[model samples]
Target chain A: MTTAADSTVQSAPVRPFAQALKDAQTRITTHMDARLGGDDALHAAMRYAVTGGKMLRGFLVLESARLHGVAEAATLEAALAIECIHAYSLVHDDLPCMDDDDLRRGQPTVHRKWDESMAVLAGDSLQTFAFELLADPRIGPHGLTLIRGLAQASGKDGMVSGQMLDIAAETATRPLDLEQITHLQNRKTGCLISWSATAGAVMAGADEAPLRRYADALGLAFQIADDILDVEGDAAKVGKAVRKDADAGKATFVSLLGLDAAKKRAKTLMEQACDALTPYGDAAETLKDTARFVISRDS
Target chain B: MTTAADSTVQSAPVRPFAQALKDAQTRITTHMDARLGGDDALHAAMRYAVTGGKMLRGFLVLESARLHGVAEAATLEAALAIECIHAYSLVHDDLPCMDDDDLRRGQPTVHRKWDESMAVLAGDSLQTFAFELLADPRIGPHGLTLIRGLAQASGKDGMVSGQMLDIAAETATRPLDLEQITHLQNRKTGCLISWSATAGAVMAGADEAPLRRYADALGLAFQIADDILDVEGDAAKVGKAVRKDADAGKATFVSLLGLDAAKKRAKTLMEQACDALTPYGDAAETLKDTARFVISRDS
Candidate 1:
């Protein structure tokens, strides 16, 4: 936060969303590698768990920063930090005592690849590392705001609450109604997505209402698409098991609304999300495509 | 953080270190209770995990802040946040995949009291809660510094690295040498302790050399005392298992230096810790007493 890196150019053309995502992936991978150090097993496991994410959250951060004319140098570590939080959540959620998944992102989960202890420690360390990255002086004074927001978004009031509700629902005699499921998804998946989508506005101290609206609708659509994929996605393309929601007898968008209705709902949400971006006009073309990709992509 | 609670100052003059610790315990417990919300199991588990313990780390933060003339109201939450981090560490450390202890602070561990999933989520939530507290605007501009320092002290480079080393030592063919054990102990216990003990100087933006030196020596002494407690302290009094370190054949101050030398080392370190506070003279009497308490306590 000592001095702003002196660049405010947003001159890069709107690349293909696919290519933008790839660029984000590359930048974040390199950023993360430079951030992590030590030769211990925990360090190795941390690197392992942080690898191979879709980088959608990271992309959202970068794209949002670009839209606001913020320098990428100032935002790249912020982008990397969010990915660390996301990756850590995945690591812990896949532990034996939690989701117990053996595979994630087409690779063995952290616990499976290293051990349960490694997963726990790696996830714990990664969580702290995210905060450390935010503390980097390069992120500017707004870094504290981001750190606080991230904590609130990911803690009991947000993602953890969603996970907790999911666990409670798994054992409850009654199935969750739509309202309840919505509340869960809003916290579990929507919280981080919303944070990422609005990060640029927070950094710029600009109005976030439009972006918030965009993210709210877009996050729901994203979850709905995840539900759709759960029902129809191929394992080879999805990179993990499919039909998990249905198999668990859990309530999801598709289970509450019929598959056809769920698909329709997602499309409507995508439209709503795009409409929220009218404030940005053509500059948001890639974001609009991102909303489409959320539903269309296999993984 | 919104408002300072009305003060009910302790009327008693500086009494025994026991009385001081009890005061810290009562304040932190009440403070934490107010901070937590919701009736869900996750919230309950979080409260449960943080309920007991000596509040030693919390006291260090509050005392350090007080030493710098920081108002009790301003530093209370910072103290609470450090305790939250300490509590989260204990909860995670007791997981089946980690230390796997069923008992902590003389009660069933979080996992034992609830379940493994609850423990995992509670610990995760608590970690986030710590960051949230640091972000509160009430913490002043230095909130960013606190957040950053806490991250460094607790992340892979600090506590996690120490834990990893300890675990690695457990499986190593040879016992860790004194230098190796010193490195592990410094990270696992010393880092956060040092942070807490120097928090006041940081908040005051004052020279930290003296407190830093005091903490460096005190932290090592604290660990040596813990090593002694593990060997000779009563399980009932200690509120956890005793002699487990010896049973595991873990290289500790006692194991490496023998009982007499370990005790002598702790005393010498305690004296060195007190000596570092010479600049503050009688004002640091409580801290000097704390150093003594660390070495002499049964737990």
Candidate 2:
């Protein structure tokens, strides 16, 4: 059942960005399956929720680890951990009380496929599992630092706060301005992205400033690309409903900045992201490709 | 604003269990307030969710830390962390899709007070906050071990799995037998309590066998007492609806064992819990009182 992407990644160090992404997807899914083996419903739902994603955050972790000379063994687990967090957020966000999406990754959302209670439990456990993975001794003495960083990046002050703001925005008197939207997206999506990209430096006990700068730009570009996709991409290719934000009259980069300007802005951020990696020289080619891919991908 | 119970605990070690519990509540609340200082709706909900519980788990953490000579500064955070986990569980469990509970601790549930989205986000953030608290350097180098332990105790194979089983049991063709009930309760309520009771040993890198044994008995006794309260206690005293289990025809400890037998079993377990604390002798008096309180208290 191995795909060409998997074989290519396994065969050589010089992988195309697509192949590397698929490779991360395969490795993380395999790792997650091994660790979460059981017949229980919650585990089954958890497995389902984590599967079928693009695994971009995971690729960032692996690539960053490779750049920092950290072992794949440790980074792979951290990669899986971030995916768990990502998947869990998606699960809860898809709940009826939240964004209320019926589809995710071209499949029924967790609540639609199973039940809301299962979705809640599965999401809850997946979050706990993320912390559990980071606490592994293989991550070395920096495990606490990583754990603390993640807790800050994803907790009340970070991702969740971003979500709260998004919900509040939906009911506000007017659409959010650009500054507010930037703040919200930074917390909602950018924080985890930054965390994933900088994890390698943290694990290596090296300076994380370079990766942080790269990630900050890269994350915003990725989100702008997402907004573009929502406006222009087909649902089939995008793997979820599109244009819903526009339909609901919700403000997004594409709406606030105009579609053409939004795309140009994404390109600028992508360049800034690549420039931030200048310290790593040609060794950061894969990351440069990743930055390019972020602005270009439809999904 | 200061109650007699709070005053008594601050003054001396010879304070009664009620005073000690109140002190734990006050201190943990203050600590949480200081840590989660934000006017954001999600933060507000998180603060509310963590408040008003009996603080029994906090007591277990503090008492066990004292027994192991761990400092209050360290254990207080650990205590607050456990409370966050406990509170998050309660908030989610009260969701309309889950237990559908309207009241908890004599107050409206999170979903009722705010909304389902707020409840979900608040509960979600609280879980993350627990790990954040544990990641504090004051907990010493054992922070990872404690984090890993908490994650395992509260994740898929532990509390979440138990909750899944409870949900499934609601529609089962046959009632769960005594063995099934024991296994379910062991995972459901027992895991976190065991973790709390043994946290001090984990923090000190000391042997945890005695505390584990005590927690096993005490956790079971606590569940039995809860069942007894469901059958015999008033709603005002219990702080939640009484006899809902009977109304729903749910099988519980009281339902299977009969009232008198259940009471006797709980008493025996209380005795066993105290017996396991013999190694600590007079220094274990508070914990022994805790075991007695578990089986005898109205709530």
Interface RMSD of each: 0.7, 0.5
Model 2, position B154: C-alpha lDDT score: 94
Listed models, DockQ each:
0.74, 0.84
Q: How many residue pairs clash in each candidate?
A: 1, 0
The global C-alpha lDDT for each of the candidates, from Candidate 1 onward, is 0.85, 0.89
How many angstroms is residue B57 displaced in model 2 relative to the true structure, after the best TM-score fit? Answer: 0.5
Report the lDDT tens digits of candidate 1 across residue range A1-299: 10012111111223476787888899989887877877767888888888887989888988888889777776888898898899999999999898889889889999999899889989999999998888888888688888889999999999999999999899999999999989999999999999999998888888888889989998998998899889988877787888888999988899999898998788788778878999998898788777777766778
CAPRI grade of model 1: medium
Q: Candidate 2, what DockQ? A: 0.84
Candidate 2 on A217-273: residue-level lDDT in tens?
Answer: 999998898998888889998989999988999999999999889988988897888
Q: Backbone clash tally for model 2?
A: 0
Clashing pairs in 1: A1-A137
The C-alpha RMSD of each candidate to the native structure, in angstroms, is 6.9, 5.1
Off by over 4 Å in 2: A1-15, B1-15
lDDT of 1 by residue, B33-125 (tens): 887778878888888888878888889887888889876765888888998899999999999999999889899999998999888889999
Off by over 4 Å in 1: A1-15, B1-14
Residues B1-299 of candidate 2: C-alpha lDDT, one tens digit per residue: 22212221113233477787888889888888888788978888998898888889888999999999998788988999999999999999999999998999999999999999999999999999999999999999789999999999999989988898898989999999999999899889999999999999999889999999999999999999899889898999788999999999999999999999998888789778989999998888888878877777776
